[model samples]
Target: MPPVWDPAEAPVGDVGAALLMVDARIKEIHEPEDESEDGAEAERGELNRLFVASAGAEGVQELLDGTCTLLYMFMQWLRRTHEHGDKDVIEYVVPPLVATLRMMPRSVRPQTVPTMVALVVAAGTQVSPNGWRSQYGDWTPEEMNALEATVFLVAEHINRIAGDHNFAVRMIAETLTRVETDGD
Candidate 1:
């Protein structure tokens, strides 16, 4: 994989705008195999649907690759934002990844784990040494607990949507290791 794009060097000014740019780039690279679906549906599902109509490992690889690109883009967009400040972005990012984990057969599970790791690493970088504190850094214990509950709202999301038991266990273990090790 290419070196992770550094947000400071090329900050993504607006998340949606960057994604639209990526959409165009993806189109430039990948011609859709199926044109039966209308442009609107195809446009929105471009990232996740790459594999459904194509044949062989190349198709599945493209689907996972698209998702990983999305993950990288979201993380770059999240740079320097306070914890949970990127909540909206996370909501947009995690579901597709979770769905990919559950919906794709185990054939891609090994490859997909790296994509999950990228998310964990991105979220980890968003925090301060003080840890997810508000701008003022004066949050109370209760407030801190509440924030912690939601700090990893994405993690909680995956936990609830564990459609594949073994895959889910591996993901849970990876997330725990990243959290415990301060994202290395």
Candidate 2:
């Protein structure tokens, strides 16, 4: 199921109702026709692969801040380079990844949403970086440690595939020029 994330698009009338709508999206994504445990597990594995973004996002500290800045910056980059692609790529990986965001404390959920959206989008395309906004409060050290990556596994993946050694490094300029700094 596709993730319905934008609260503005919610049909509800109040903030509380909108929160319900937002939370409901997590439930909705997990409700596939097959309710077996195996089905759910498959969804989770796929979701993990999606967030990895070929970025080896498993223990790099550069993107960590009071909030998940890696996620925020990546999403900002996606909006500029692949808005429609974001829509296309996100649906397939919604279950656990969306669930992950839903699992976060409500205090920081709003701040981390773009990171979720960005990861969902970055799953398919080679969408990448540019951006400046990041939140600096309302985060736990454990949470920050849980999610951070400094290596671009995809850059190597693409380079190896394309046989263009310089292709990955060249992307930095393209991404920077197109992406905007978010969360200022």
Best candidate (score: lDDT): 1
Off by over 4 Å in 2: 1-69, 79-82, 85-89, 96-138, 149-184
TM-score of each: 0.26, 0.27
Once fitted onto the true fold, the runs of candidate 1 whose alpha carbons sit more than 4 angstroms away are 1-71, 78-88, 110-184
Q: Point to the candidate with the largest TM-score.
A: 2
Q: Write the per-residue lDDT of candidate 2 for residues 70-97, one digit (tens) a residue.
A: 2323334434444555553244334434
- Model 2 RMSD, rounded to 1 decimal: 16.6
Estimate the lDDT of model 2.
0.36
Q: 37-117, model 1: which lDDT tens digit per residue?
A: 568545645743453455345443333233333334334334333234645544555456556544534333444344343
Report the poorest 10 consecutive residues by lDDT, candidate 1.
Answer: 127-136
- Residue pairs in clash, model 2: 54-154, 131-180, 131-181, 132-181, 132-182, 133-182
